[model samples]
Target: METAFADYLDEFTRRDWETLDPEAVADPVRVAVVGLGWFAREWALPGIARSAYTEATVVTDVDPDAVETVAAERDVTGVTPEEFRSGAAADAYDAAYVATPNAAHLDYVRAAAAQGKAVLCEKPLEATLDRARRLVAACRDADVRLMVGYRMQTDPAVRRLRDLLRAGVAGDVVHVHATMSQTMLGELGGDTDQWRLDPELSGGCALMDLGVYPLNTTRFVLDEDPVRVSGRTRTRHEAFADVDEHASFRLAFPDGVDALCTVSQNAQHASRLEVTGTEARLISDPAFYEREDRGFAVVRDGTRVDVDFDQVHQIEEEFAYFGHQLLADEPFHPDGEHALADMRALDGIYRSAETGRSVTLDEDAA
Candidate 1:
């Protein structure tokens, strides 16, 4: 297992982060990762391992077999869910990473925050807006930092796009079209025990599972909130009888910027983000995912300019930023308020989809 982890470490090169002083990275923030699922194992673990300012000291999960498997590969203490909720476990770490199922997020977060530990929660905040608000308040009352894991918000390509828009390379941004889809049914066929398929566990369906990407990414890039939303959804397969298989929605921002976004569980794998303005347009062919290499292009005045970035890891930057917030007293980006805003927008979207009418959102809902 150690040999395998060493090989995994070799697959990626070390990154130089501008946010922290390489020589000054000491007393790494100890983190307890609650949930040993696919995302936690595949992405979050590797990302946290590469950081100089953070250490994953403890891991928790309900399945003892899964916990044993992960514990063998990593040098971290593995505890069952019951032990993790106890007071002794809370005192063992400075922060907790909540990567449990969607429905379990709030409970894990509150447990960690109750221990006076900072929390890095996986996206969506909660299954519903009302619950999400309560979760945020709990963390605030505990006086702990709460950051949502919107990995792409720290992506180089996404940040470059934002910079171009700020530089007026796209003039006044007018429209955005974003799409993200994956064949979940084909990928995990007949896996009824999969928590994501259960509406109670996953909150909604495709929108809650996949739609949050385009929805949150657009808002991140634009740095603006929408005033209204209209949405429609459908469940195309019996396997997804309890949840949506596809969803489409449009958001109207205050400054006349309109965003059309779609998510699906029954489509060819695709992820793209395009923004149009009066002067030019910017496009990210394979946008919003953590990858070694991705391209961003700009089309202006009948000429195209392309920029290709070297190997970059979104998860690495995410944990590094969390470390920055913990160690350097830096304000956390995409904080709880950010997730709450997205939740509010999604709440309006689901309502609009159910009633077949546009839903208006209050700008000052916090």
Candidate 2:
């Protein structure tokens, strides 16, 4: 058996990925995609389409026309939400990818788990902390693997950053600063029915959507949970009156390690994660994109070492890891517990922002 990290050995500068061979597992996983929306249609499907370790067996959506459109292009069976919940569909796939909205993740995940299919869900796990915990419990009780769709966990550059931190190359982590910003309506060109503005559907605003990148990245790099959080959220424009347009939060982890993160729906353009330690600093600009290539840098004692990574399709990496977990019974890196921890911290952040006070967290609660 090959080591799990063998493929990533030359990921930093590898440009010949087209010639790279596919994985040799016992059986490729058959995945039923539960949503046919923008993210599922664009980013996720392309990766799943490429991976030899996974196949999109069926597509599910409330809108049959949308499902049929995606099905025709992807060459997968299209099913309505009702048929997807039936027993016949349950037995068709080894795993289900929950690409639905943040708020609806719980029901879909629970249903998939109950049918004894492994689940890979998009970030946040659920819209809120309570549901997140329940989803985790449901999966656990069903004895099925539950993984969060966190591409950064498998991203080459991000993995290099984590490796450096773990190897103490940065020397005693002290602080981290991250930012992810985008003009949602501008980029999406969608109307208000986008479901992101509704508190009941999307949960929170920028923090719940784009903020997860920084939130999950900081935690992944540090490998530590936050003990306290303080945040502030605002509705910068009348268009965002029902939800927050901007949010900034501070996290206090054990050993005095602190992190600052900002997420915004009204910003020009910003995506970065910077880690500063006693000895050096590591930075990743455009930290959370699905592009095929990106660059990062390491700075120490006035010397800079820039590293450029090629073939950065994190979604493929995510699917590969999920397939490994299914075939080898390997642990999912950012497992359900990993997501629940982040949801708990986000819950604290939202409460702190609303009350204008620091929210302390108990390690035992999560």
Q: Write the per-residue lDDT of candidate 1 for residues 1-366, one digit (tens) a residue.
A: 224322322423333234568469868899899898877898899989887778888888988988888877887888888788775677668999999888898998988888899999998888888889889999999998999999887776777677667666677898999998888766556465688878888888789888888888888888888889999999868878888889999999987889999989888888899999998888987886564356677787898867544657678878887887789787777899889988988888888999999998985554
Residue 171 in model 1: lDDT: 78
Clashing pairs in 2: none
What TM-score does candidate 2 reach?
A: 0.93
- Model 1 alpha-carbon drift over 4 Å, by segment: 1-17, 188-190, 363-366
Residue 72 CA error for candidate 2 (Å)?
1.4
Candidate 2: worst-modelled 10 consecutive residues by lDDT:
1-10
Error of 1 at 324 (Å): 1.3
The parts of candidate 2 lying over 4 Å away from their true place are: 1-23, 363-366
